[model samples]
Target: MSRRSSFVLAALAGALMLSACANTVRGVGRDVGNTVDATGSAVRDVAH
Candidate 1:
């Protein structure tokens, strides 16, 4: 393969990997937020 083609492929792969990492991080943040909300709700219920 040509050097240009290899560079392009590498760049594309890097972009894909970065995007996947971003999505996974976003998902983890949401999961953490949900857990916090649930915990707060449980505490409120128990206090009531």
Candidate 2:
């Protein structure tokens, strides 16, 4: 393959990996937020 073609392929692979990482981070953030909310609710329930 040509050098240009190789570079393009590398760039595309990097972009895909970066996008996947972003999605994973977003999912983790949501999971953490949900856990925090659940914990708060449990605390309030116990207090009441």
Candidate 3:
């Protein structure tokens, strides 16, 4: 393959990897938020 083609392939691969990482981070954030919300609810219930 040509040098240009290799470079393009490498760039595309990098982009795909970055996108996956972003999705994973967002999912982690959501899980954390849910955990906090659940914890707060439990505390309130116990107080009442």
Candidate 4:
């Protein structure tokens, strides 16, 4: 009983940590994508 409870707690903690990491990575990717898009638009404007 006690062993099972400990395992469950550990699993929950690991899931939470992984979720946070994934969220951070997703947010960074979005920011980078936006910057790249803006840069591309600026270049197109300059060419015209």
Q: Which lDDT tens digits does candidate 4 get at residues 1-48?
A: 699999999999999999999999999999999999999999999999
Reference-based lDDT, residue 18, model 2: 100
Backbone clash count for every predicted candidate, in the order shown: 0, 0, 0, 0
Which residue runs of candidate 4 sit more than 4 Å off their true CA positions?
none
TM per candidate comes to 0.98, 0.97, 0.95, 0.74
Each model's lDDT: 1.00, 1.00, 1.00, 0.99
Best by TM-score: 1
TM-score of candidate 1 on Cα atoms, chains taken together: 0.98
Give the per-residue lDDT of model 2 (tens digit) for 1-48: 999999999999999999999999999999999999999999999999
Lowest summed lDDT over 10 consecutive residues: which window, candidate 4? 1-10
Residue 24 error, candidate 3, Å: 0.6
* Cα RMSD (angstroms) for every candidate in the order listed: 0.3, 0.4, 0.5, 1.9
Candidate 3 TM-score over all chains jointly:
0.95
Which residue pairs of candidate 4 clash?
none
Ten contiguous residues minimizing lDDT sum, candidate 1: 1-10
Clash pairs of candidate 2?
none
